[model samples]
Target: MFLFEKAVTGSRKYWIWIVCLFAVIGAGFLAYLRQLQEGLGITGLSRDVTWGLYISQFTFLVGVAASAVMVVLPYYLHDFKAFAKVTILGEFLAISAVTMCALFIFVDMGQPTRVLNVLLHPTPNSMMFWDMLSLGGYLMLNAVIALTTLHAEQKGIAPPRWLKPIILLSIPWAISIHTVTAFLYAGLPGRSFWLTAIMAPRFLASAFASGPALLILLCMAIGRLTKSSGLREPVQKLAVIVTYAMILNVFFVLMELFTAFYSQIPEHMEHFHYLFAGLDGRTALVPWMWTSAILAVASLALLIPPGTRKNPKVLAAACGMVFLSLWIDKGLGLIVGGFVPSPLGAVTEYAPTLPEAAIALAIWAIGILMITVFYKIALAVRESLA
Candidate 1:
């Protein structure tokens, strides 16, 4: 209830932001209602490329939710006090990201009831089942851990002893969510583009990078918006984490490309070709893939140099590049790329219809709204303690 107090009371600018989010949400809701009435036919989905923007966002956000561990592990396990200021930010991010992930799944399903069916009929062997279980469990874990830790802060006392175990469990639980999502892709025998053993590792590496990068940007924003102090050290430390993870993610991508072209398998090489150079006459993804490629390289340049990365402005730009680069590659291109040059070897390109884009935008705005309210509550608690 007090949390709601903090969230509900804010400056004029904050109210403006919330109102803007509401506008987007309202428009998106209208689009979704039409979708529910008309079925998926209103979207760009076809028999050839069934999953589009929604599933890609679902996949990318699973990684973002998992990346919270980058902050949690060091702070709790290693006693890295520099992260003390921003650890809650990471946890709140996981909560919001997971919420968005679930919403993306719901929208992608076309019918809300389909989600219940997954629960109503349990299939232990199914990756989708495990994915759902992992996501739901992670969401609860973060929500509890965040609220408990914040309450403990408010009282100027340590979190209860029992929370120790839950905190520890959440670290690995975070990793599991992304791995399971990767398995959802890698497990499909029909999607050759996602069949590689490296998918899980790639997902984890990118999660570590992109997730923390977003955290850095958000902490930067929160510091400005709330007039908070001591965020710089943690943000810089996170930059180093992003640096390493970005390297690994790019390496994993290169390895896939190497295997594809080196093996001279048309099925494999064709997917890469379709992504980078366009296969036959279809080139919808070509420009976006190239943009991701450029951003990946450009971000590496900014982050690898200590002077450039240590500078606050450059670091923000670099983090922005890191987030957007992976968002394009993994969030947008990855899923769409897999389905293209369909199992039958036809070059089919998929694009999101306007309503599809609107609905996706609404989902993103909803996530942003969650983050805004969550952070407002958190900042209020901190200010009160101060």
Candidate 2:
């Protein structure tokens, strides 16, 4: 009832955007049901492309979720004045992004409805179950932290002393969410590419890079769209964060390459080959891979220049390019590349079916819609306070 009341009476734009979000989610649900009824056959997922768009989104959003820590760390721990105004907004964004991360996993599962089965009958040995637990716990923690802080602010009173520990606890919990998600990939047995020891580090590096970049982009968007000053100094600080993270991300990727080639393990070498060299005659992914590489280079190149970094438009474009590049690399390229030259030493490829693509689009729409509505409400509340 509270959520409903907030939804309808919130704002015309908010309600309209939510309607669009629901429409898309409904379409995705219909598609999901069709897949459920027909089995995984309806989706582009086969043994080969077992981890498709949905999993890709899950990976990407973990980075998005972790990015909130960037804001929280500076604002709360370091006592940065620049982020004071926007730290709560960052937390809310994390909440919504993490929610979508969970939903994406649900939609991707063969039996999404049976997700509760893990809770009903705990599987201590399963990485998946651990993932579920960690994600759920992190989500609750973030929601509690964000809401309580907001409630305190709204009442024009200090947040309860107890909430400090809870908010502090969420910092580790945030990192754990992304780490566990990376474990989901790295723990798999035969996927040599994903099984690397560096996988988790790479995951964190990319998460830090892309996640902060997205937040910076979102902050800039908010400033332009709503005429809000909205943490420009902190955003610049975050850009510095992304610059270092990108360097590390590139370093890790190169490290992955070094290990694969130097070890001369055919099993490991083959996967990297597919990513960079296009296994067999399949060159479709090659261009995308290069695009990611070049863009990463360009992003770091542009961001390091002082004059260019300070310009909002230039900085925004660089962030956007890095974000899109990482999206392609993590979402499409990594998942698809891992499965090539299947575990059995055979070649297979996967292309998404119409239903699968539609479902993917719908999930993304829902995330955007959530962001839009939440921001709208938050802006109104901030305005009232002002």
Candidate 3:
């Protein structure tokens, strides 16, 4: 069936949502133009703290995109029937997210043409080279898997045998994308905040938690709107995945704290202090970090117990807390914590300027647009089949 059948068939509400996204995208494009003309100086970035909102978001979303494996693995490898319906949604989400990741990298480059440098030079020693390969490969894999499976389902036929190897390939491909992303930071010399052996595991843990938490919320919203989520069992199962992953994420963080404090390494300890208790009286991130802590604890309370997590309303709240908490900690705090206390012991802070925020918003709007259209198309096909 043609995508024109359902991708374009949306109610007034859907049309309004798409229009609003375009409005945001248009505004973002204007702000991006300003940044392009003025360069990185327009944003809060400085010589000391070079990376800011863009890199932070890129870091966080990498995990979200990688989380698709949580769904794909269970359904394909373990044959978990509960995840069958939600797997394609996860794939579509990966596609939208990786697209945003690439855009974030694009805008962060003062000269957009710099992307060609990476593409053309092909440095084997650079972590960035591998990161690009991982992300690019994963994006194509998910896109192919999702589109092929959906096409098959619309016609009520099994996906071709050739697709199985590709599906299996995506499971590890998803992991490589985030692992390489973590290495991008960890491999950097003198960045005490990101230098650690467990960085990849930390990234994976948070990705699994935040990604599935988002999927749960998306499935719930879709279910409410169409009255046919085809994801009730899958959503519940995903809550279980979120619970354990969140636990591991928290544990991994605690392990980092021990390594920093126990070893009494001032360089390492300073980053955590800067995040939670600010150094040199610059407390910009202190409040946000604390808020993330509070929300993390509250979410754990809501999710740890079977009784509370099983409640639809309660689960929704818990998932919201999980998503926001990780956003602040991983998306915003991690990047700042790493850059502050620059190599020479100068403590600099970073925040997004108006244009910077707009550009970020625009990227988010683009992702949402992709997801909205993809979901609409998927739902329409499934409904027709029913």
Off by over 4 Å in 3: none
TM-score for each of the candidates: 0.99, 0.94, 0.99
How do the residues 1-386 of candidate 1 rate in per-residue lDDT, one tens digit apiece? Answer: 75687788878999999999999999999999999988989999999999999999999999999999999999999999999988898999999999999999999886776679898999999999999999999999999999999889888898999998999999999999999999998988888899999999999999999999999999999888778999999999999999999999999999999999999988888888899989998888888999999999999999999999999999999999999999999998899999989999887789999999999999999999999998888888888988
List all candidate RMSDs to the true structure: 0.8, 1.9, 1.0
lDDT for each residue of candidate 3 in 1-386, tens digit (9 for 90 to 100): 55756877778998999999999999999999888887889999999999899999999999999999999999999999989899999999999999999999989997787688887999989999999989999999998899999999999999999999999999989989999999999988899999999999999999999999999999999989997856778999999999999999999999999999999999999999999999999899999999998999899999999999999999999999999999999999999899878889999888889999999999999999999989999888899999
Which parts of model 1 have CA positions greater than 4 angstroms off? none
TM-score of candidate 2 against the unseen true structure? 0.94
For candidate 1, the clash count comes to 0
| lDDT score at residue 137, model 3, on the 0-100 scale | 94
- lDDT for each of the candidates? 0.93, 0.82, 0.93
lDDT of 2 at 86: 73
Considering summed lDDT, which 10 consecutive residues are worst modelled in model 1? 1-10
